[model samples]
Every structure is written in C-alpha cells, then in structure tokens.
Target: MSASHYHICSRNIGKPVEIRTRDGRVHRGIIHRVDNRMVYLRPLPQRNYGGYGYGWGWWCGFGWGVALGAIVGLALLPWFFW
Candidate 1:
C-alpha cells in the first residue's frame, strides 16, 4: 500500500494502527492523526513507553497524558512551531 493508505486516513479515524519507528521498535495504538510526514499514535497499553526513533516527533506510552496531549497538539499544527 502507498504511504497515504495508512490507517490514519479520515475513513479509519477510530481504528487501531501499528507504527514501526526508525529504530526497529513497534507501537500499536489508535490512529489519532496523520500528517504529511508523521503519524500520531496513542500507543496501546501493552506497547507503551519504550525505545523511540530519532526524529522530530512526540511519543507517549504510559501515564504522561498531559505531555502526550501537548506533543500531539503541536504536531497537528506544525506550521506554528516550524
């Protein structure tokens, strides 16, 4: 499938997604949102918090709800910060 075919598309709004970071790690979560170059995921309970790929992005796995929200919000509006 093409990159745009990821589960984060509009039709799969509430579906689950699997993310493989650049470091060979994996995460599974709800497809919160997807932008041109990044995928925002609210990682599943079992696969939350672990090694992350090196890149400009946000990640949340366990109890850091507030931090997670902040990152996702920023990613959604990258123009403001970029």
Candidate 2:
C-alpha cells in the first residue's frame, strides 16, 4: 500500500469501505478502526450470519474483514493524483 492509501483511510473513519487485498479477497464493511499497520472492518449485519446465526464478526489480525491495503470508501469518491 502507498502512503496515500493510509491517508484515505484516516480521512474517512467510521465510513463504509471495500478493500481488496493482494490475495484477491475482497471485504465489504464499515471502517471500525484504522492504524499504521492495519484497517479493521466491521462487516455488515446481514452478511455476518450464515444460517442459524452462527458466524464471526470483525477481527483484529489475520481473519475476516481485516484487510491490509488501500481501502476504498463506499460513500466517497476515489482519490486521484495528477
């Protein structure tokens, strides 16, 4: 990730974001928290449950909804550099 990526995450705290990591996995959720190393994501309520309401929520480290890269905020325009 670039420095601007962290900048975007910092500016749009507490907003919805979609993150695509280097592994090709995509995570969609709200921005629970952001720091120098990682960006925590709180997954949507409906997507959290599997069948009988047995599923995990947001995590800190290597798990669901936790992405390490440039985060795209759903409610904001993509950052552009000229």
Candidate 3:
C-alpha cells in the first residue's frame, strides 16, 4: 500500500491496526478511542503481550519518558551550556 493511503484519520476508529511502541513491540487491536493527540486502545486477546500493567503487558514496550527527556536535554545543552 502507498504511504498516502495509510494516513490515519477520523475513519480509522473501529478499524483494526497495529501499534509498534518505542521498544519495538507490536500491539494489534481495534481503534477504540482517539483524540487530537492520543489513542486509547483495547488490544485483542491473541495479540496481548502476556502480563498486564498500565494497560499493557511486559512485552508490550517501554515508555517514551526517558527517551524524550534525554532528547530534550540534548536540545537544551547547546543553548544553556555552550
């Protein structure tokens, strides 16, 4: 499929899609909820990551908190330290 054809929009809700988190884990599920900047998902049983917490399993993926924080820090270094 073409990249333009895959663009996500309002119609994506209720459709099945796969999500690849920061750590490379994949979650396939229906698009249960969507807002301007976020998606709330309810994964299918077969695609589950096997241990649930924060609505995700151990194999689901890692959070973006650390990565994004480090990126922000690096971006500020040139301005504040240099």
lDDT of each model, Cα atoms only?
Answer: 0.41, 0.57, 0.39
What tens-digit string does per-residue lDDT give for candidate 1 at 1-82?
A: 3243433244564455444443455555555666555455564334335586454445555311111212221112222222
lDDT (tens digit, per residue) of candidate 3 on 35-68: 4444545554343466754552332542221121
**Model 3 clash tally?**
0
lDDT of 2 by residue, 4-40 (tens): 7777777887666667666666666666677776777
> How does candidate 1 score on lDDT?
0.41
Cα error of candidate 2 at position 26, Å: 0.3
Off by over 4 Å in 3: 1-9, 45-82
Global CA lDDT computed for model 2: 0.57
Model 2 regions lying over 4 Å from their true place:
47-82
- Worst 10-residue lDDT window, candidate 2: 73-82
TM-score: which is higher, 1 or 2? 2
TM-score on alpha carbons, each prediction: 0.40, 0.56, 0.40
* Winner of 1 and 2 under lDDT: 2
Worst 10 residues of 3 by lDDT: 68-77
Best by lDDT: 2
